[model samples]
Target: MLLFSPVLSLLALSVVGQQFTNPVLWEDLADTDVIRVNDTYYLTSSTMHYSPGAPILRSYDLVNWEYISHAVPRLDWGSKYDLTGGQRAYVEGIWASTFNYRKSSRTYYWLGCIRGSNTQIYTAPAAEGPWSRKGTISNCYYDAGLLVDPDTDIMYVAYGNTQLSVAQLSSDGLSQARTQNVFNSPSNIGTLEGSRFYKRNGNYYIFVTKPANGQYVLKASSPWGPYTSKQLLFNIQTPIAGGGIPHQGGLVETQNGVWYYMAFVDSYPGGRIPVLAPITWDSDGFPVIQTVNGGWGASYPYPLPKRVLESPVGTDTFNSTSLSHHWEWNHNPEISKFSVGAGLKLETVTVTNDLYVARNTVSRRILGPASTATIVLDYSGMKQGDRAGLALLRDQSAWIGIKNDSGTFRVIMVNGVAMNSNWSTRSTGSEVSATTVTGGKIWLRASADIRPGSGRQGRFSYSTDGKTFTTFGNALVMNNDWHFFMGYRFAVFNYATTSLGGEVIVEEFTLTAA
Candidate 1:
């Protein structure tokens, strides 16, 4: 028998209590939608310009998740060309997708929107599988919604162009069978989209959200309109409001027969990031969303089923034959640039000369509000012009590089055509004495802090022994553009040089939340 002290018993109870507390924030998740197949929960989100168009994440509980695999290899649309200038088109490919599980067919269907003109649908037998493109929905419509009638086996797609419209799909869940003009409102609820259809107590409910405003729940007897709009689900004028104009989500009934609405809110500086909210129905059968700070709502503590995979940090050893899912390329990764043997060696390849084309660089978004990432590399046997260092790259215009040439370290900031020196914050570069590395292991670390209004900025440190570190002068500040993509990234680089046969070897990389 074991004897327990009072302090020990209290600590044990505290640990058990923590398991019931849910997470407040979901980092690096955007345009999220979820579905449960069997006992496992599957989630999908828009991947935009990011190499993996549709990100498929798995979780046992909604709070904890891990990157499983991508639904699409690359965006069906062309890269950078598809984006509006200065916007983060790369991160915006398949926005607001709907995931449905068909028990009759034993398959999972994914319907998502491209940039313009029509929604794209994909299907796979299993949650984790090889998904194939079924084709595009009629004309270009964004933020599509799909619902299947159990009695009729008919599928309908609700989308908005200049106005919201409903269209019927074939039995195979491909192509439109019939199209109907749903509803059009000029003001207050103009151009409403993200429509979800549900039936309860003989009445059909269609929930749709208007841009930069609030969400409206419309009721009708038939699937096609002659619909009546109800009070706004959320009022922005309220004291504790939901942020970033209400957006689309799904109205789902869990196995326990409780109803909930999943939606997104633009809470960050940019109104693009997605946040989850819990919903409840009033006695009158109208849905209402609980708002926080008159902004986006917080996630609920719903006891839902899920399949969680807590990924291990700092596992990009490159010793395995295959790359881990933890890594994501900016756009499409050049598979030939990397090789894993005794260690990982990234060959210097021709990156896009234009900043927009540099999406091929592989990176992972900083997962926490603040984090520190470190990489160990061997940059020996390089000439004066030959440069290799860890880079904090955002775009062509905004980035900072810490490069080593011959025996000296140089810190550089790239802003448009100007490369500034750290000491003066002016366009210049000053050389410093080279730090010695034994066993070919040179450690480089960067720490980023995400602050409200101030944006994210951090310092870079270098160490030879991996223990003692010296901060390289000057903090690199990331651009505070919420409309565009924002995240701290770590990367190993090899630039063009006249000297031939110079290669940079990366031994290991680690990212830890501060």
Candidate 2:
């Protein structure tokens, strides 16, 4: 059996031939929506405030997935999206999105919403995307769901917070023709959002997220619904994982007619991680999640898909002409601030007391239940008061970096602990530990042990020769909470708190299962 780390989520299971496990993706991939084109399955997830918004992943089998591309490389709506002038867009940017492939035109359509703007649609000839902005939907559609009717080919968007609304779109999916309220969840059912619409077996099915409860479905004979609703999955809790419910995801069927539901749990400090479950439909055609021995459980020994693939993230040599799909900027990265040709060159843009607001911090999703990340830093170009290193970045994060002070270079480990606030308003105080280095070239690493019994801690280390590593600072207690609304990531950052001339070249970066 190929078992994952039991400490990663609620529980872990092994893959045996056609049998696989739960939480199919152990990384931070939230607000997931899935679509099948031919034999290929494509998934798009929310990357709030992270540049390269709406990452699209591909899979031949439902069990294995790989990062393929991003729908939007950068959110250029405003300067705040770029972290310009001390402004930030944390827990904001492209939220939940709807992805579809139209057979009529051989075009791919993606629609998502950002604050201060209308719902935007991006189109491409293929999923890899040289995607162009088609246009925008007039009203704000939070957690929106888009559907291109298979018969009429008319596009429809279903979105709302407490009140659910469906709006008709033009054939091009650019303009809104008409809109109306579909269904409003009563006050007792928490907040209802994250709607994904579909047409199956000649019936219109709309799946919505009901927080604190699991996901529910609304079935209608027509697109504008006089709908009937039912709870699809009520028991989504896992005793071993301890994370909350698996809500806010979409459904997809395999080539051989096997059904599965993709959703996420609020695994804090880790971000919203994706979880998968085998689904079955009853005679009435409503989908149901398979349970273990008539109870809600995390991992189950279900038959896996026949195909398998390697993970999407791994080591990078900084040799690619463009940034890898595995990487995302903290915000819209300043193109001039970083280059990939001669190693990853990160030029300091501005001096900031907070690394959370620093621009051009390239990051990749951290693997779980445990993983180790390392980065080789060439600090020859580092200037005075410049700090460049590797970090586990989130609202409450830590780093091991080389800081150039005067003419002396030192290895410093600092922990950014935020006090009682979200990412944007969090008051962070940096605690510089007692460690020093006098070398111009150094390698930094962070190991995260997020398993249950380990107390979910991350520790940092540094090596001057890249052979012998020395531990630094105290263990950072990982905050597994929704306060940050995202997962922790392995990040490479360079910034000057004094001036903006300092820079660092990252020669290599690697992430390995620990």
Candidate 3:
């Protein structure tokens, strides 16, 4: 029988206690978009510059969410563009996407703007697998929104340029049928982006956010006509002033006829976290958002979904033929890098000339806030310049990794400068002899804390067994900017050298909120 120490027992008890305190689901997701299909719910959100553009999450209830798949595998649209060199060009590759379920055809359609260029559309038969890319719609617009009119069988794509325009989508739901400008202000009221169209009882309503102020909802009787500006739904001049810039969200009406507004808040140091509020209709039939004195947080006053299919969290023996959902590449992974039989073996390939280019790596967005992520792997086949580490990355300039050097693993921080911070020495608790530990597994557990003025600080620790953990001593803190361009992500990478073949066998990996 395997014996455990008292400290290990106490740590396990603390983990159990924390779970009871926060039973709600998806406490860490941000930039969220949600859609309900019958009793099941699906969500997608921006993964700016990350390998997977938008993440597809499924939920039985609005509260608890599980990551299912990604909408776009890579952001490689055209040339080898690098957003990592402080260029904010690819901001709209995955920002503010909408998931709409067309009841007529029983198909799921996802629409998103490609920043400065045209709006792109993708469709899937089921929410789970085999999505089709339909290509760009309008070449001149940004920040696009889509809605289907059940009464007319007409699909409308609404987007914000200098003004707002609505275009009819073809029967195939890809190309544009007709285009018309719906609303355009006289003066420069920032950018009239983040628009949503809704038809309620013979009236058409459009809700948009003014980049200058906050957000206001406008009404129109027809899809394209004169729109009347109404009172502001949310007012926050500055984001730090508790003004939530409700960029992109869904106005969902429950089956029981209850209305709710799901949106995201600009909680900077806290990241752009998600918030839910109950919406009520006024005497004039306009939706009113309730703002309490303190601030907005997760509110699931309604009962959560009871019928859920819970997948195994951490039980991959790596005997399959293909990569599991548990495994992700840095950008778009080459098929030759990985193989599975006795165990999951990952080989490091030569970086392409387009290494700094767009959409090179394959990665999944970090799902929950405080989660334990572990992978049992062997790293005896690494040479100088070859590395395998768990990375918390956001482009090439902004990333940190805990890497294995030859036989021993150490915590190393990497920014843009190739030699400035590469392979800096850091301390850790566990140490295995270079020769003794030939091909043993190493596990890392990380926790994220958004401290004031500190931005997002992530602390990582390592353990041989899943029991005893030793802190890595140093923490990585992200620098915050006013633009709100980037968010948080965690990944794994293996870089190969010339002489040594970079191979790692991953036995099992799991992530559950701390």
Candidate 4:
């Protein structure tokens, strides 16, 4: 079904040429690493417990990127990854990935830490992957970076807490070999990790972050070596109101040999968003962000090249036969429970009352500051005791949906606030409202006004006729707690606690930003 879509037009115009400003991507794509191969650029980042773990993004220009695919379909470490045996792996699936491609073997490799499970290596022929797992290495190097030396074809990984080290890997990039201490950051550096390894100009460079001290660069003549480090970005300026402290990302060079450093800042509500800074090399062959007065500024008038890829997050019409790359489940999605044709059909999965623990809840990051998301849900197939809704997912979230009891139905709105910072299922403040419904379909909208000084609040509304929307519940204070460690997202969920076979069909979802 070829529908007339503005999204496709956007993709075309973008490829012709488009410019972007600071904080290029305003979504929670944290712990990012980038690499350029020929005219295309590929990126990998930490999804942390989100299945289809280790998302790989593709870009033509460094500024605009699209979600291409994921390295792992689902983590199979323990019962936690499957949400079975009453176990969960929240904030622990995959973290801080390093992405690389080897021209000699024409293989793409991704190395990421699984926290308690150990570091995993995933490989694929092309970046958009049917990636094969290369088994796990016993080391749990926090925020580890992987590099395959071009000359020697030897793999090396760098990681640590306060004191960092580089360890060698076997030829096949499977197991670890000898280890060597690399750099020992000073105590005052404050929160140092997220290492990304690079080899250039016959020298090995490691880009790592020190939260309070900014981003640092460590250089060594040998992959396994005694290295010297220097501060790359300190007191860097940010263009956005609440954006600064650019740290934790990898570097990429454009087709014209122009280099740029892609990093992230602690942008709350939107989580850690991507930042692009122009980079140049020093006389001693050190990469430095183009800055005035020896410090990188908040923003630059950088001219970006263009690509024809769609933006990473936006509206989904569900008119296609398959789901788009913009969507990802909260965990490994139970694909058997979902189908798509005219609209997205999500069958109910029997689970607890907590939405976080429920399976098959697909989500996309909130494009923030001020944005509104609207979805049309058809609940004609809902059975008694079935709960289906459009949710703004975070520790603190609210949803508006339809609840059916036998032949009777009602539109219900629920607001929940998490108690613990861990973003667990338990919530202390939860409220609900119900109104009699006369039809089998409804349109729900979540409008957020998170502009820096606006106090970051999200409000819920519903429309039975799809034109007039009525505000239903209290404002949800957009939360930025450390435990959730991320931003809110627009999610569609249908679950059953009493029985099975209930389903919800989402016609379309539109996300508009101011």
Candidate 5:
């Protein structure tokens, strides 16, 4: 006899054959939409206000992925995205979206909303793109998904919340032709969003998610009206231990039509992170999430032949003219204020009391259950009032950096620098620990504990040499709230408390997690 346990959303188990764990990358990849091109799989997800929005990932097998390029080169929606005049666009910009390939045009489409404005559209010929904005939908299509009929080339966008709506796009897919209410959740279901529109066996389907956690699908014979809804995934346990329920993602079909669903779990202070699960359609034409013992398993057999691939997290040597796709500017950066060559040179671009208002801070997502980010800084050029170093950036943030106070360089760790009033407003955090040093070159680190619960903290450390590191400050309890919408990031920043022009050179950056 074989002993068995049903709820396997925690342990990494091997049922019969080779298996891989869930929360796929253990990185902050929320609101994901995936598609397949030839033998490769492409995925893009929400980046909120992070410039170079919608990061692209490539996978030979859905179980492993690599950073390829970003779909949006810049978040040029407004001046606020550039952090102009201390205006910020946090929790704004691109949200949930669709990634589709139009075979007729031989182009890839990226459709999503910009803030509360109209739904914006972007297209590219290739996945690693020079993506360009084509136009926008007349009305805001929040948390939308796209489906273009191959036979007719007619485009349809499923959008809206509890009161769902489907907007028909012009034949060219550049504008809206018509909009209609398709389905509405029962008053009991509350909010329903994150729709991924699809068609199969002559039936059109709209997959949607209900707040915090829950999923459902609506089916109709015609594109518009008379749609019927059915619950799909509601009480699925999170693949990540102690994480929130998984919901709000899109489905993709393999080359041979094997299906998989890529969704995210609310695993903060790392924010919502993506997870993968096999799915199958039933005789009734509704989708079902395949799991072990009627629950989401922490590990599952690879849907495709598995391959050992390098993760997106690794060292970035500043040898290329442009930063790697792994990095995103906090907002649209001032191009003239930064460059990459021998090393990343970031000139102080803003005179601000808060890091929130500082421009040109480039960052990478912090991995979980825990991860360590390290950066080597050549502070030979740091000027008075300039603060430059490694940070765990969010609304409530902390950092270990070199702060020049009255011409004296102090290696310090600051905590509780928080956003207030609004996303654009922030208070200057206090230095929790400091040590004077005649700075030349230094190393800084932020090891984050981003597991579930409120005890998450980022421990700060520093070193004169690359090796021997000394603890800098009391561990900062990171903010784990849905309010930020985005997760904590390892940011390389430089800003001035007085005048700009002071700069710092980041020699190298590396990240590792377990």
Candidate 6:
């Protein structure tokens, strides 16, 4: 079914030409890396234990980027990822990574550390792929940068914090040949990390970050270096109001040799968001963020001259045989638990009172700085003790939905449900109103204010009919903490407090600018 969509108009504006804006991706796409292979630019971001970890996004013109595929189809790290025996991997899986395209072998490499250790790797021939797990490297290189030296076909990784280390990888790219400390920071510099390795003009450059507020360049003749360091960007004013400086991402050279730095700003609630800056090299071969009054510009000319495509979330009838690529499960999903045909039918995979541990809770990023998602939920299938609905999902979450309270149907608004760092959850998260509803079909909508600043809140509303909605409960504060790195998302979830067979049918979901 072809539906009139606002996203189509946004995509069409690019025909006249599009501008590269700050917070280019307005959601939680953090700890990013960008690489250009031929005419296309591919990006990778830290997925933080979410299934389909380490996402791959592509931009034909660098003005509009769309989802390609995830390097990790599932977080197959261990049983902890499966919620087996109540074990959880929250904030544990994939962290900062280095993504590269090697021309000689015609492969794309995605390498990162899980939970500050346990280095893992994945590779594919194309950005969208049949990916192969290249296996874990025995050495733990935190926040790694992979460089396959084109001159000699040797692979090297620049990793670590404060004192940076470079390790030469084996011919097969799975193990380390040798390791050496290449660069170190002074006691006062604070936390320095986020390394991206490169070779340009017969010299090597490793871009490193002081993660929270600064970025620096380390230069040397060899991968394992007695390297010299220079400050690149430090505490620069952010174009985003009340946001931190842009730091910790990758630098890419366009097809025409123009350079650009794609970094993320630690804007809480909305999470760490990607911001692009045009780059130029100094006479001494140091990279510079082409600044607007010594601060990154809010908008600039498009980074590349290519086709324009912006695939933002839009109206969905839930009629597709398969769900769109924009959707991702909370963790490694049991595939048999959910199906998309006439509508998205999510079968509860586990008997859980907490939504955080509930399996097959499907989600997608919210459109910012303000937007709303209205979903039609067919609640006829809910059994006793079943709760299903729409949520502003995070470690701290809120939901508005239907609860089959001992087989008595009710529409409720629940807020303050929080998950502990240890994976346990508690519900200060409560149903404020337990009003009985007349039907199994209902509509729920969440309106969010995600602009960068302190203390943003999300509001929820519900409708017995599709057109009219009643603002339900008190707006809940959103999680801006860096520890809850995935940020807030719109989730469609169904879980049972007593049994595992109950389900929910999401007939349609429409996302619109608020």
RMSD of each: 6.8, 4.3, 7.2, 2.7, 5.7, 2.2
Q: What clash pairs does model 5 have?
A: none
lDDT, candidate 4, at 122: 85
lDDT of 1 by residue, 479-508 (tens): 444544433456555653444445577777
- List the candidates' TM-scores in order: 0.78, 0.92, 0.78, 0.92, 0.95, 0.95
Decoy 1 TM-score against native: 0.78
> Which clashing pairs does model 6 show?
416-429, 417-429
In order of listing, the candidates' clash counts read: 23, 7, 9, 3, 0, 2
Off by over 4 Å in 1: 1-25, 79-92, 196-204, 235-247, 267-274, 290-308, 311-314, 340-344, 351-356, 380-440, 485-503
Q: Which ten residues in a row are the worst by lDDT in model 1? A: 1-10
lDDT of 4: 0.77
Residue range 22-141, candidate 2, lDDT tens digits: 667778888899988888889999888898888888876666787778998778778988999878888788778888988888899898877646888898899988877888776887
In terms of lDDT, which candidate is strongest?
5
Q: What is the lDDT of residue 125 in candidate 4?
A: 94
**Predicted candidate 5 versus true structure: per-residue lDDT over 176-206, tens digit per residue:** 8999998878887788999989888788999
- TM-score, model 6 to reference: 0.95
Q: What C-alpha lDDT do the candidate models reach, one value each? A: 0.57, 0.79, 0.55, 0.77, 0.85, 0.82
| TM-score between model 4 and native | 0.92
Give the per-residue lDDT of model 6 (tens digit) for 410-456: 98899989987765686648777667887789998988888877679
Which scores greater on lDDT, model 3 or model 4? 4
Q: Could you give candidate 4's per-residue lDDT for residues 1-514 as a string of tens digits?
A: 2232244433333333334577787778888888888888888777877777778888777776788788887787777776666667777787777878888788998877777558888899999887989878888767888887878888888888678889898877778877888778876666668888888878999888886437888888987667777888776766567655777888877778788888877766767778887889998889978864555455555444444456433557787777766677877777798988778999987555777777888887778667788889999998888888888887777787787877688887878746355546667335567888877889998887643332678888999999999989777777764456666778888988678888989988887787
lDDT of 3 by residue, 345-398 (tens): 667665311222312233433444444455565666555555455545442222
At residue 465, candidate 5 shows an lDDT of 82
